[model samples]
Target chain A: MRKIYFLFASLLAGNFLFSQATPPPADDNSLSMANTQGLLRTQLTLTPSWMMKGTSGNDSTSISSARTNVYLHGTLEYYWTEHFSTRGDIYYFLNKNSAPGGLKKNHSLQVGCSYHFMKGMSLDPYVGVCGGISLVQISPMDFMKGDSTFLPNYQVPSHLDPVWAPRVGMNFYGQHVFHFFVEAQYLMGTYRPAIGPILSINEIRISAGLGFNFVILHKEATVRPAI
Target chain B: MPYSYYFSKLIDPNPMKKILVFAFLLVGISAFAQDRKPNKNVGGQFSLGVRSTISLFSDAGSSMGTGAGGQFRIRLYNFMNTEWFGDYLMSSIGTIGTRTDYHIGWSVMFYSPKQKPFKKYHPKPYFLTGHCFDYTRIAGNNPFYQDPNHSVASRWSSAVQAGLGFHIPFCERVDLSLSAQYMFHLGKDITAVTRTAVNGDEFLYIDKEEASINGHLLISFSLNIRCADLWHDHQKKGGARKAAPDPDGQNPKHIEQ
Candidate 1:
């Protein structure tokens, strides 16, 4: 056990040092303009957004409950030119609830698409729809009492089914550097049980947070010759 | 030569061996009681302990069993308490010969700082109540298997336990304790069921209830280290020694005199 712990510690230290070391610069002129356009135009504008959400839902018992859900929403917006752009949104949701006797944690991955109403606006409003599968985990204690039994509980079989949802939100860009916005999304799906009746599951979430966009490449200025 | 033969016969006699064993038992009990002095300043007070029974007893002899499960508690008051707990058990039968089982579960407990004592060992009894979502899988060649089609039951059940415990100070801020608890399954029948072979071709279902009493027994040992102390300084304000006696006999004479 001691040797294993030391080995893990050394591996973690090596990873940390490796991540901190800078990489050598590559040759600039060998890079093609098309590759540069693909990298700077699409990759640079693509920003990853993270948001914390709170959700309330009803179980099979029809009891009202609340859960703290944290999700990472990453959006990649591509512009064929400046005016025509398409945005692809991917979201990952993790929900955790600490109940009286046990706890339940669920993880879901979703991908969707959206079309912005006005192009190049600091505050861009968009409407989109998403669908993906969710993995639901339920932990229940047997003969114990109170919250102490919540931890050592068993994990039930995962629920695998495509979950479809629609989202609407506006991204508010402030000072061209920071963008903060809130969005509401609803998930509707049914838990296909391996045995027994099929149960319906629904979740609604509202989230808002800020993010920064880094300029990896700046457009060069054009100078006209004196005619 | 004759003395050696007689001595060997006396030492090897079977009836005499039984008598010697009885005599040893009599002496051991008496010696144990004499040494059993009530612990004094070894204050075993203010403790919470929990235990999960790995084995369960049912009323029916059919031997359809469930895994042992439970929780523990030591609460000085309504708001301040420490808890330790365990997960629900899954039952299974072994391949070779013996009855074996498995339980996959988790537990966590926390204590607020209000209920503990400042200087003395305080033992407080607490009540435990919680729900256990059990995924019990039972497999055995026993004749009393409950359901062949569905060997596992996924259901949510609740439990309650009441018990007394004591804490012995291990360090200035650490204490350990041992406690006994009576745990009861509030709802559902605690019975094991199995299928019996009938006429070599047909199978008949048999439900066995073993120890179907409302509750079962549990014993637990726990260690507690003080996280935060509120009144340690207040107790120190008074000298460690007992207060000096008053001259008046109105006060206890041992101190007053």
Candidate 2:
């Protein structure tokens, strides 16, 4: 757990340092030409998420939204020449026990597309859908086979789930190299177990993060578009 | 609270709530995308984004499930682009089990952009068709109260889906899209049930039966960003051109530098 905290601290420090050192871009989102494709953005984000449960499948309840967990997400994307563009994402969710065994940890891989609808001079609103798999580890399910006590250990083993997240949010860039964004996402976990009563895990995550938006072009092409 | 206490509650009895949220977001995005005139500047761009989905019905139990997926798209022309996508969804069956499904496919997205120069938000409607591989599995805990079942089954099927959708430009490089489609699957089916046998040993019974064909309704909402702009500046500055060139074209001396 200490190692995890150290890792998160290091990442946060790195992001802050990078932002401080790099000069803000002149052709930010708002300043760029309205219709043409702008900078292709490589975004690195960190969020503290609230993980919660929806309802009961049996008598059991999973993680509640009250628990704040750490989430790290990275998105690689292209500037849109068309109406939409594809995106690939990988997310690491800090320890939040939604499954039995002990504390639970998750690694997720997802792919989807983003549609830019409401473009703003500073703030742009959009929505999208992402689907993928979450590889998870939970506490061991066995209590005491024939130990000191005769209680049953209800935790289940680690496994993978088919999951999806639908998100709606906005991107804010005021002609700066670093951008700000906040979005709401619904995460649904589909893991079926063949033992005691268990409920499905669903959660809502609202994230706020910083982004580095740049482009790949030739030297002559680096000239900022006319404002 | 103890992890065990809350962990068992992970299975949601009200699965529709999640489904409802997903649907609502899709509608909301489409409406937002279409509200204004689109920028209408289709260029050479590649993008990466995340997609979220909800399965309307599972053939086994007719239950809705939640899933996540990804897509990689390349612009082929002003009116055409190709996308490769893959996703997985998990559904709940009563209190004991879940069904897992996987889909991987590619589609040709044909676009129609109105030739309005100064539209606020552009509306680009598209049509798509693609083939995918589908796999599903069913698992439950002990078949009996104190007994165990030894059988578990899973199947992989080939599938295809065709649908119509709209891409609403949210920003210069961001797009929100909603698509509705039908999927057809060819494979075997896996099922698990509680059963008692011989001397009354209660065990879980899992079996694979021939599934002639299967199909379902699929809806997807996505947020995608184009990638070309990321390397634009570095490339324009002759970042790569500054490096020593390879004489034979097979190897570059800059790699050693």
Q: Per-prediction fnat values? A: 0.00, 0.64
lDDT for B13 in candidate 1 is 41
Task: State the DockQ of every prediction.
Answer: 0.01, 0.24
User: Which whole-number lDDT from 0 to 100 does residue B88 have in model 1?
Assistant: 32
| TM-score (C-alpha) between model 1 and the true structure | 0.30
After aligning candidate 1 to the native by TM-score, how far in Å is the CA of B229 from where it should be? 72
Q: What do the candidate models score in CA lDDT, each in turn?
A: 0.39, 0.62
lDDT of 2 by residue, A62-109 (tens): 543456666787787554543344566777876566544534666777
Which runs of model 1 end up more than 4 angstroms from their true locations?
A1-95, A100-103, A141-154, A195-198, A214-227, B1-257
What value does the lDDT take at residue A147 in candidate 1? 36
